[model samples]
Target: MTPDEFTATYREHYPRLVNLARRIVGDQATAEDVAQDAFVALLKATLHDEQTVPRFLSVAVKNRSRDVLRHRKVAHKYAPFETFGPLSAEYALSVALFIDIIAALRTLPASQRRAIVLRTYAGLSEAEIADRMGWARGTVKSHTARARASLRRELAEVA
Candidate 1:
């Protein structure tokens, strides 16, 4: 599709797509990200028909939402705080804190978010992240450092 057509399509359907994802994912920011990802997929697609674009985007959003739900389930299953044994006060507090940390992570810039997730969640080293992300080691270090500072500030505010 033409740029103008794509812009119009994005403007027309973005909000509805986000709302649909939000209903599935139960998070506004995540829904927005999911919708944006769908748009990116639409751009990458070869389809050019106006009538097919919206349907394509809708399916993309739903698929991404399902992926997010699956990831959430896996994360919850392996959450470090789950080692607390039972639903005690400490377990509840830990779960709440983990949720807050995730929200804070979402508020970070894309580069910072990627760096932090690779380092913290995936247990990758700075060199490994740099290699995987196709960046210099210094760049990875900077992104992770900035991400850490931002997360500290965000989590502090939550506390």
Candidate 2:
């Protein structure tokens, strides 16, 4: 793609790509970084079919997001104390609650988790999620419903 073409593609897809990455990684800043990296990688790659660029970028973001999540898990396992820094009591409590929520999200099945995150965090409507996920609207609704109930139960148990 030429510079102008690339710019247009970025403008069109950047938000959706960032939302996808955020759903996977659970961090907006990191999601934006991952999406930018994917676009940069696409710019570097030589493609025989330019039409496949969007799909390629999406897959690239997904892979990068998974890699980041894996790295975070391993690092947290080995160096849990490194994450703790100076913070007010209220801030620390909020962080703790966020961690608990993330843990609850992890317990969900992959489809349910994705549905919940895409709906709640990414703020995508059911139809949008259905199109992106290649599922029927009903499937997205079911997944979101079940996931919400599961999360509510889990959080209540924690409380």
- My TM-score estimates for the predictions, one after another, are 0.52, 0.52
Candidate 1 structure, TM-score to reference: 0.52
lDDT of 2 by residue, 103-127 (tens): 9999999999999999999999999
Q: Candidate 1's C-alpha lDDT?
A: 0.94
Our model 1 lands, by Cα RMSD against the true structure, at: 21.1
The segments of candidate 1 whose C-alpha lies over 4 angstroms from its true place after superposition are 82-159
User: Tens digits of per-residue lDDT for model 1 on 13-112?
Assistant: 9999999999999999999999999999998999956689889999999999999999999988888975635797887899899999999999999999
Q: In candidate 2, list every pair of residues with a backbone clash.
A: none
- Please give the range of 10 consecutive residues that has the lowest summed lDDT in model 1: 81-90
The positional error of residue 82 in candidate 1, measured at the CA in angstroms, is 7.6
Which candidate should be chosen as best, given lDDT against the real structure?
2
